[model samples]
Target: MSATTAPASEIQPLPPAENARATRETASSAAPAAIRHYLSLPFAAVLAGIARYDSVSFWPVAILVVQILLAFLCDRHIRAHERMEPKRWAIRYALLSAAAGASWGAVVVLWFVAAPPANEALFVLACIGVSAMEFIARCRFPYGYAAHAALSLGPLVVLLLLQAAPSSFALAAVCICVSGSLILFGDTIANLIAESDKLRHDNIQLIAKLSNETREALQARDAAEASARAKSTFIANISHEIRTPLNAMLGMSQLLDRADLEKPNRDYVKVMLEAGRGLRTLLDDVITLARDDTMTDNHNDSDPALAARAVAQLLQPHAWEKQLRLSVNAPSTLPRVAADPRRVRQVLLKLTENALKFTDHGGVEITVGVDEPDDDIPAVHFSVSDTGLGIPPDAAETLFEPFMPGDASYARRHQGAGLGLAVAKRVVESLGGNIGFKSEPGEGSTFWFTLPVANASLSGATDDSDADAEVTPPSDLTLLIHTGKLRVDLALSRILESFGNRVIFAESRADAAARAARETFDVIIAGTSDAEMLAATPGMRAPLLAVLFPNDRSPASGEQILHWPAPPRTVYAAIRDAAIRKEPAAAQTRDSQEVAPIDASAFAALEKSLGLSTLLEILQSYIKTAENLCENLAEASAAGEWDEAGRVAQDIAGAASGLGLAALTATARGFAQNVRNHEVEDAHTLRNQAQLIVGEHARTRLALASLYPDLAA
Candidate 1:
């Protein structure tokens, strides 16, 4: 697992010089401790020899004293100069190791020579065994281990060989072999440790190098970001300065064009306005480029014909100024597209203006139509073609770059900063549209874009291209159109106003009710779900003409339902007839006061037949029953359920007639008949009629007490 580990075959034995250097490091680190440990044996032996024999062991004491002094001196020398080069530290370690080896050897020699022959032989065996144990214990060094083994075993072997016996020579040979094998084993271990040390040093260097590279990369990125921010701030300030003067130019030129002038002079002023406006847009794109900003899409249902025709109208003056003809080629059959009208107009206007700017003597054409469907998602395509200077070859690559004038001279005459094409490309891409151009030199260029379409909020119920004559309301009918989208609100208002009704705008039912109380509105056009909210507002008695869109499940709503499709005007006749009122003002006023307090003859006859008390109780029951029937009939009629409304209306007629309320009976009969004929709008009038009858009944109840003087009480 360690990076320093190598296979047995990969590990090479250290050479003599390196082996000696490494072994000396191990001796300086660990040999002095071993020498001090050996001193303990001398102390133990001296104590035991003095205790068992009645004699003092001066030699053992002397040897122990010398061993202690030698270990202390060697420890002090190693600590004095701890940090040393390998070669110099190796020489110093060798000298200290040799002293430790000789000191240990002297202890062995003293034990063998001074002890009795019987004990000396056992002591010599103990020395040989301890030498082997020391070699195995301190396995980390080669040179230090070799010197210690040699000094301890060499003198003992030679002394044994001098006995001139075959057995002594054999013992000497075994000692020699043991020392040499131990030195070799220590050398191998030292080589492994040295190799691991080198690897750790190399890895540290590599890590430092990688860290430095990562730090430099982060610094470079921060610098680039800082530079970009500085550029954006500078461009934003500069564009603001340029646009101020350009705005003045555009305003002055517009005012001049409006003033009285000759035809040629007016055309010149128009050209000036177009150039100034184009320069302002170029400045806008400069800020966009620096900040990488694009137009915020305000999505709405926009008609292709409206956007194209609007742009065409805007560029007509500039086209005339250049003596070039400009036209819009579009069909009335085009569908309304869900798009941002502002951006669409911007793209169309800029492209058309560009075409006019490039064309010298020929015409520029703008065409719009539906492209081939992509998986049933509607797509609208527009192409602007110019008969002026076609793009040169070199300009094609950087055509969409900022300040890119395909031909410098033509761009200079056109007088824009030249970011129009680039900004247009960004706008198209942001809208998920495709934009490009096909140009042929000496001919013309056609710049085209394709945008995916979605269904407009207004349903495409029919494609009626013909605009009908405006409907003039027979009476002054005020209408409120409640919707958010401008195009939808405008289109619906135009359709309703075609009948010549004054239509107004309202944010909500409460707002409409407040305005209606102050101003007269004959009808409110709103969603059916808002029926309760609309009912809560005071003074809104007009029947709601609920507008339905695509995916609307409720087929019919209210006394009239206006289903707005392609041409909102198609619902003209139904919406008008339901909204109109046919009632005499004087008769309605008189009926409200006199309808409820019927002459007492009707109650008088019933009171004579029954008792006065019984007649009064019966009259109360009849009023409660009639009120329920009238409310049910109104609800059913509003929902366009003629069958239910008629059924309830019959109950009202029977109940009113049986109770001797002649006016209510007559009104209920007429109301029932109107429901049978499916003239539900008349039901609202019928409802008003029943309310008056109910009001008249309340007055009659009050009159009985006032007139009969509680004949009752």
Candidate 2:
């Protein structure tokens, strides 16, 4: 369709202005040479054929001159058409055609009178001219030019050619009409072919554009996801690195508490313990934030109670220090949920800590409940609301954004990174839940999140209200506590007692000295620097023993001390050696060699018991899924779906976590987090690193399993 085409209602008899405009539009879209050749070729051929009739015949010369004039007119019209409107061009062309027709009609009538029964060769030449002209015109403008040229020129030329042959004039007229109709038919076929070709070309372009966009999109998404995963990994690694040393410090301080240290020594130990706890709290927050930032739609709602409990334990000290009331309103028989336990705890603890921070007089409350629904899976809602300072309504939405606080002056009044709500929101959303709040200024706030329950609780799982003992201590060996959380001390005490080990508690070195003064024991276990005071106090009799923290370096002379870089187990082993009669060297060597190489695969039995096989299966499935992801990455990159690619990478990270590929899990988690944070520029390297970790972990696990066959089983 032409741009000048009007509606049917607006369609009027062809006026010169309208026709000229239409012609110009059509001409501008086509090659001028094409239009000229179509219009002039037939006339030139007819005139040349007539020229053979007589060099002296004035009719032939006059026709040749008129043909030259017509050609000139066509050239002028085409040039003018470039500057004029389509309607104007069309009108001019129509006028030119009429003028050419009138002149040719006069020539035809004159030729019939002078040259009756014209040569067959002349008529053949005219026929050929008309056929060639129509063909070329049809090639140029299939719909308009070709139809008009064939209709006007074909029949007229044939009739003019036949006029010279009286006997064949009637037959020629009939034949001309048939030939004109045939030209019209050929034009239609040609138009259809040309249209189909144009359509195919358009379709190819559209598809190519779409594919390119899809690929670009995928690449961008992958990049973003890779960045997020890197961030999560960094958080986890940093947390672990800090935690190891913190554990040692806190442990030693706890041992100091048991010793009979002077007030200054006891106070110093307490300060160190508090600092270590503070560091732990900070690390936990970072980890939670990282995990939350990397979460996606497919994130599981089930989180381990043990892990979540660990986070809560970290914040418990902070709450105690503040002297704020705190209570966990979890169901007596709360079910586990399919969520990132680390993230969930982070969110809850953040809310609790925030509540405690602002509430000088009120207590913080946390409730964990399940909503019964028609579906098989139950929804568990955990709400941590506090009677602390409430959030302004206007700032509610922005509060979840990083660095945006409830009050602009909060930084001056309270000390925090202002990431609590942001982290909480991200964590909740990641765990397939929502987080919301209700608060009034100067009143308080309530923050809540909901997730699906992982499984029904066992009857006895909730029997131990104070967190069930997780670590089991060895029996037949004397145990000593140096320093650590009260709960850890309590748990360790219970575990050692259950194992039939004699357990002793001392707040300072002086206390241990008093115990030693009264008994001649097999071993004396010292927790911290209090060992110095304990050693100074002349013990009655016992092989002196000291329990070293993971990073503890100080040593007191005349005492056998061991640093438990591997913690409790190694500490107990050292105590056993120091307290009991030494086993034969050969037996000690055998024991040491027996437990070597307990790597990832060695824990397969435990893994399966914990239902981690599903994770392994997912890892195995990654070979296929990853292929799809890669393909999707390419497509998304081409399509410019950067966000989608990031999501895909996150999926891979989560799957890696299930397989117990911690390193890989960290890497993927980092990438996903970075993407979510809009840190995409660094995505490429991160994603590659993440993939490598996953691959390496898989191989490491398999190799370890191979070395220790029973471990895998």
Candidate 3:
């Protein structure tokens, strides 16, 4: 017989991915077989070869035992396949396969060398069984299977053919046919393993893609939030800028009574004061609602009776000013409802103020009572009605739009930002209530709301309402002195000084003017009786708030004028309201409603948690990172990395908003959205807008500095 070497291409290697899958399958599939080979191979060899008791039989038994040990080692490696890194794994695996296949071949070759011709049947049977298994389990990678099959069967096939006999040749033919069948069958399994691994790879890529997309979406959302925050910050600053001079004008007009001014001059000052106050209201309206509504804290439980009383008391002043009767009708035993007290009061005051603002005659009435029970929770009802010209149908639908004031172009005359009703509607809905109105064109209009009382109890239940905190002035308030020939200056100084305020007196009018030019004063004490003198002086802009008084009831035109022997209540009110803007009307709008240097109280808890030093460090780090992110975003945009820019913007906005830097957050939010959506030109424009908005000394940044002073340094 002629011999031929099999080419390297006889076995098509498995793909890299398929090899891994085959390794794992090998571990699990080889486990039971491993136990069988480890136990049975040596046992079978010893039992079968012992009767012969020859060197050949002994060597066959030894090789069989070694093959069993190799099978056990391969089982251990396969079991730990997951723990092993794929690097060099294929090479290690191939070596193990060659060793395992050669071990089996050595035992088969031993059979011919050691056993007598009578045991040839045993060799044939062993060769057939071993070749079948190599094809079955190891077939996923044809290399391992082919190695085992050739090694196990090659010796037996050669020996059978070398006999030169008919029966031996026929047996060899059967063996060849069986080997071919196994090899052909192994090819099919190798393809299946490759396909399975390919699917797994595709699934892994899909999962990674989804994770990336989700992350991008989160970043876009955060950026949008920054834009919102930026908007709030910008509006707050703009409001402060607008009201600075307007407050000065109002202060001047309020001083007209004691300034010893002429009647026409007094009237002119009164008109100026009114117009200034209206302007301040517009600013307040914008600033008050500029923040995210969800971010604003709201108390959602209060008594309707108390709310009615507060609103009626607040609006009664307006009613008196208009010479219209104001009435409140509330039940003696009304229950408390789940609702925001401030929002409820705001809604009632807004309705009442609108009623008085429009009414020329008659009166306004506010009523609070329990409405008919439509549900188990019951409802607390409130109504504000006025005998004013009713709302026209054309105007009714739009009355709840922000900045939508009723007809002033017609015979109607009123001043207000159209946010009250809109805000009222929102508050009502938030409290799980419904608000509506009924009006007759010539008669009157009644605005009413019904709120759920699920958590409410009758008036007899113990009230858990917290008393309002008392307001007190801090020690050593700085005051500017402006006095000329009046005993009241000394008395006023003593009163203020007793309350822990430091007073610096100007020796002369010349000195006072010089002091005013250089220093900012919380309040100014002026005891001059000259209206003409003050009318010519330029009013301070959010610097020195003047409180002037005179010798008698004569007009003294100063910033905040009071008659001689000024009432304590009058003096206190002047001081308290000095910094506050006059709301559009006598509406009991938010007190301390000036652009207050951020309520640092908001940071008290945070400071306590992180420690002031740690909090400051985090904030400083955040600012630096945010600035870098902004720059990188711009570069990414230039490079057309919109997704990357969006991600960065999202990060910037999230950090800024977390720091309560609304302006930066709002700006970043919008810019990020534009970037994510691939609005290239719009995104670039928005990025510029954000940079302009969040520059150094930006209002939001300034406010943040107030919160963390060390951050500025």
TM-score of each model, paired residue for residue: 0.43, 0.43, 0.47
Model 3: lowest-lDDT 10 consecutive positions: 466-475
lDDT of each: 0.61, 0.54, 0.60
Q: Model 2, 495: alpha-carbon shift in Å? A: 16
Each prediction's RMSD to truth:
23.8, 23.0, 26.2
What lDDT is obtained when candidate 3 is compared to the true structure? 0.60
Ranking by lDDT: 1, 3, 2
* Shift in Å, residue 684, candidate 3: 80
- C-alpha positional error of residue 58 in candidate 2 after TM-score superposition, expressed in Å: 40
lDDT of 3 at 74: 68
Better of 2 and 3 by lDDT: 3
lDDT of 1 by residue, 1-713 (tens): 23256654456677756665554455464655566566665655454344334344666556657656766665665566555555675566556556666766776566555554444344455566667655543455566567767776778777777877676676677777777776756656656655565565567888898899889899988998888778766675566556545654554564465455676887788678767666666666667666743456666556665566556645553454455656566654567666677677778877787888788978888888888976777778899998877998888998888788788988888785678787788878878788999999879999998777756532222212211111222224677777444555666665445334688888766776677556656776665555445655676677566665444545333435555332222345445554643234334333334455454544554454344565555555555555676677657756766655555554555554444455555565555555444455664675665454455444545665565564344
- Where is the poorest 10-residue window by lDDT in model 1? 461-470
Q: Following a full C-alpha superposition, what root-mean-square deviation does model 1 have from the true structure?
A: 23.8
Writing each residue's lDDT as its tens digit, candidate 2 over 280-314 gives 55555566666734555343333333333433434
Deviation in angstroms for 161 in model 2? Answer: 7.0
